[model samples]
Target: MSTIQQNIELAIERWRSESVSQHTLSDSSAYFRLAESLPLTDLDAATTLAEIFQHELTFIPTSRNSGDWFIWNGIIHAKDEKNLVDDYLATEFANALKKTADYATKYLADSTMSDEDKAAGRKGMADLYKYARSIRSAGGLNSLKTRIRYEFQQAPDFFDHDQRWAVMSDGRVIDLENVDEEPLAPCPERPVSRHLGVSQSGQWPAPASLPTRWAQALSDWTPDKEVQDYLRIAAGAALLGHGDAKNIVTLVGLSHTGKSTYINVLREVFGTYAGELPPTAIVQKYGGATNFEQHKARGKRFLYLSEPQKQRTDDAFLKALSGGGDTITTSKKGQDGVEWQAQCVLHIAANHIPEFDTSDDAIVGRMNIVGFDHVFSPESMQRNKNLVQELIEHEGSGIMFWILDGAREYLKLGHIPVPTSIRKRSQENVVESSAALMWLKEMVDSGELVIDPDAYMKDMITPKDGYAMFSRWCFDNGEQLPTQKKWLKDIEAFNHMPAERKGKRSDGHARVWGVRQSAHRESRKLHLVQDGGSTDFRDLLTQLETVPTVQ
Candidate 1:
C-alpha cells in the first residue's frame, strides 16, 4: 500500500475503536480523505471512491452545489466548507436516503401490481431512484423545491459561525454528540435533535423578548447574586449541544428552598435530554463493577439527580464518578464490561451534600458545592404555584438566551470559577469530613496520642501501625481512609517531625511501618511564632479546627 493509503488505514482503525457501533462509511472517515489525495478532478473523485470502496456505496448529489459535494454512503467527502456545513447535515441527508430505501422496499412489496407492471416498475419508475437523483441537472434530494429544512437549518449562530457553546456546571450556556447514534438510523425530522432539554421540542423559538423576567424573578428569589448567575450559567450549559465540563454541581439547601421548583424549571426546560446516570435504581447502594459500568455506559449530556440521597445512592458510584476518567470495565448486564469514554455532566440537588471521602484534593477538585440557604415554605410555594411553570415554559426561552450568552462567555474563559463562598464551604466540608482525623490531630496536640521522639531515636515504627492510626482516625470521623500516603507526607511536612518510623505492630507477628508523630510539628509551630505567621492554617495538619468528640 502507498504511504498515504497506509495512513488512511491507520486512521480508520483508530476510528473503529472509538466509533462503537457507528460503522457507517462516515464513521470510519479517514478513508474519505483517500479521494482527496487522488490526482483526479472533482467529478472523477466520486468514481474513484466508488471504485476503491465497494462496501455498500450509496451516493447523493446535493441540491445547493451539485458539482462539489456528494454523499458517498453517509460520508460527505467534501473538498471545502462551501459544500459541507456540519456533521448534523451530513447525517440527516443520509437518513433521508435510508428512509427512501425503506419506502422503495414497501413499494416493491405491493401485491396488487400486475405481473408486467411489477416487472416494469422494478426496471422503471421505482428503479429510477437509482439514477433519478444522480443526474447533474435535476438535483435529487437537494432540489430547492423538494428540500427539507431539517434541524441543521436552525442555529445559524452555532453552525454559521465556527464558535461552539455549551452549558457549565451551574446550568448556563458556555460552549462545546454521543458516539452511539447509529449513522444509518432514521433520525426524526426535528430541529433540535441532538441536545433537547426535557420539556423542549423542535428548535427553541426566541421570544419577542429574551427571558429577562425570569432573571428578575430569580433576582427576587435569590439573595446571593453569584448563585443566581451560577444557576443561569448552568441552565445555559445544558443548552450546550456538547460540553467539555468535568465538574458536578450540587445545590444543598433546606426544605422548600425553591430547589425543587428550580430543578422542575430545568426539567421543563431541558426535557428528555437529562436523567440520572446508572439510573437511580440500577445502581447498588454500596457500589459494584456493574454500577461503574452503568456509569461508563451513560450517554446523557446532562444527568439530573433531584435529591438522590432519598434513594440511598451507592457510595462507590458516587466516589468513582466524582473522580471520573477511569477507563472502567463496563458492560451490558450479561456482557463483559467494555471501555467507554466516561463523560456525564452531573447536576445534583439534595438537602445534604453527600460526602465521598472528600478530604483528598482529587475528589474535592471535582466538586462544585452551591449552598442554598433560602427557603420558600410550602405555603409560599403554594402561593406562587404557577410561577415555575411560567418561568420554564413561557419565560424559559428567554432564560435559554441568557444561558446561551453565558455559554459563549464560558467558551472563551474555559471554565466558570466557583464562587468563593462555595469554595470556602467545600473546604470546611473537607476538614470537617473526618472525625477520626480531627480526633487524631486533637489527641496528638494534647499529648494523648503522643509519639515518643526517643522511640524514633531507636528507629522502630512500622508503616502498618501508622496506617492503622490513620484508619482508626477515619473510623472515628465516619469517613473513609482518603489518602494514607498524603496524610503521612502532610504530617512530616507540617510538624517537621517524623510521622513514620520502623516499628512493629501490637500483634507479635511482624515488624511494620507505624504512624509516628512528626518530629517537625513542634519546629513548624516555633517557626510560625518566629515569623509573622499568625498560625492561620500555617500547617496542613493543623488546618482542621477542633470538633467536639462527645461520641
Candidate 2:
C-alpha cells in the first residue's frame, strides 16, 4: 500500500522481465543495479534489498545446478517466475531484513556501538560478499571438486601428479599430494578401499637401525615422567602423521636448566634410526624452493631447528611455521646459472618467541607455545646426570624399541585426542587455537578419539591468573590490552625483553621498559621502570605509580 512497498514490487517485476529477456546478466550485478534504482527512503528499504539479494545468491548453489550455464539458467528462472519465490526463502529474507533494520534503528537512536565495532561489522559484511561470490562461481559439489583439482594441478612446482584424492561426505576433496604415503582411515560412509594411498608399495623402508638406537638411547638416559610423557605423545603424533606433534617442542627455562639437555636426549633417540642433522643442515636443505617443490619436500615427517633467537625470527620463518597446508618458496642461485628452490617440513624450537613487525593476529595465532615453568632444583640436576649415564650405556634394548613402537602406533591411529592439560597450555594466548580445537573435535566426532566435552571446555574457556599477569605486562609495556588486532605487537615487544624481564617478580626487582609512539612525531618516547618495583628501586617505582592506568 505504501510507496516503498509499491516500488519493491515494481522492481521485482522489472527484474523478472529483464532476466527472461536476456539470460546473460549475473544475478549479483543485476541485484546491484536494481538496488541503485530503488527509492531507499529509509534504512529498511536498503536492508530489505540486501537480504533479498543474499537469499537469492545463497539458494542458487543449493538448487539443481550443473556448470556456470545451469547456474545462470536457475537465476534467470527464479527472477522471471513470481511463483518461484518460496515461502521459506521469503521468510528468511524478511527475518534478515528485520534484524538489520533493528540494528540500524538502535544505532541511530542511541549511538552506543563504538566506531571500532562498526568497522568490524563492515569488514565482516565485505568478507561475506567475497564468500558469496566464491560459492556462486563454484555452482555445485562436482564443480567445486573440478575447480579444486584444476587449481592444484596448476600449482607451480607441483611435480607429483600421482596424488590421490578422497571425497569427504561434505563433498570436499582432500588431496593427498606431497603428503605422507600412509593410508588414512576411512570415514563411516566411504568404502575402506577409497582410503588407499597413491604409493601401493605396501610399506616404505623403515630406518634400518632406528629400533636398536632408540632402545640404546632410552636405556642410557632417565627422563622425568612428565618429560617422557610429552616425548611419547610427540613421537606418537609424528608416527601417526599429526604434523604438529613432530614439528617442534619448545623447552622453555633459564640457562643451564636442562633445555639443551632435553634436546640432546631427543636427538639421541632420533639418531638411533636416522642420522640427525643440526639446525644448519635443515636451513640449507629446504630454505630456497618454489611453493610446489617446497610442498613436495615437506613429505618428511619431522624437522628440528634449535634455539631460534630474536634476530633469526623473520617473515620467512613465521610463514613456514604458521601457515600449515600451504607451500612456501625461497629463491637461490644454482650451479648452472639458474635459480634453485628447496622444500621441507618446518620444525623450529626457539629459546624466545619470534619478533614480528605486523599486527596481523592470524599470523601469531597459528603458533603453539608450551611453557616450561618448572624450576631446576639441585635434585633435578642430579637426576639428569644419572639419566645421561644410563642412556650412554644402554645403546640398544627391546624395552626402548617397544616404547618407540607404541609411540609410532599411537600416532598412526590419529584417534586419541590430545590430553586436556596439554591442549590448554598450547592454546594459551593463541586465538586461532579455536580452529585447532575444532579440528580435534572433528576427530572426536569421527570416533578417532574419546573426548570429555565439559573437561575440554573447562580447559580452554576458564581464564587463570596467568592471563592477568600477561594483561598487566601488556599495560606496563604501553601496548593495547588483550585484543586480536594488537596481538603481534604485544608479542614482538614481549620477545624483545631480556629473559629476566619475561616473567613476573614478586620482589619487584625485575624491570620492564619500552618506547611508546607519540601521535605528533615520528620518533617514540622511552618509558622506563614501567611497573611497580622493589624498595631498592623505590624512586623509579614511585614515578611509575604516578602514571595513569589505561582504563
Specify the highest-TM-score model's number: 1
Off by over 4 Å in 2: 1-227, 239-247, 272-300, 311-323, 330-403, 406-417, 429-477, 480-551
User: What TM-score number comes out for model 2?
Assistant: 0.33
Per residue, candidate 2 scores C-alpha lDDT tens digits across 383-461 of 4565644543453222233334445445455433344454455555343223223323333455433333222222221
Models 1 onward score TM values of: 0.48, 0.33
Candidate 2: how many backbone clashes? 17
Candidate 1 Cα lDDT to native:
0.45
Candidate 2's error at 278, in angstroms? 8.2
- What lDDT does candidate 2 reach at residue 272? 20
- How much is 231 displaced in model 1, in angstroms? 3.0
What's the lDDT for all of these models?
0.45, 0.35
Indicate the worst ten consecutive residues by lDDT in candidate 1.
Answer: 154-163
Put down candidate 1 lDDT per residue, 1-551, tens digits, no spaces: 43333433444334323432332222112222321232122233233333333322222222332312222222211123344322222233333333444444455556455665555545433332443235323343243212322311222112112113232222222223221121222212111212334222224323344456576656545667887766666555544533345566777877766666666776665544455543453245453434543543243445667555334444444444543455434444543434433334567777888555323444444567787666766666323878777676666656655655556555556666677777777655554454534545565676534544445432333444445556656666576555656665444433335435323334443322223445554465456666745655424333322222323
- Report lDDT (Cα) of residue 74, candidate 2: 18
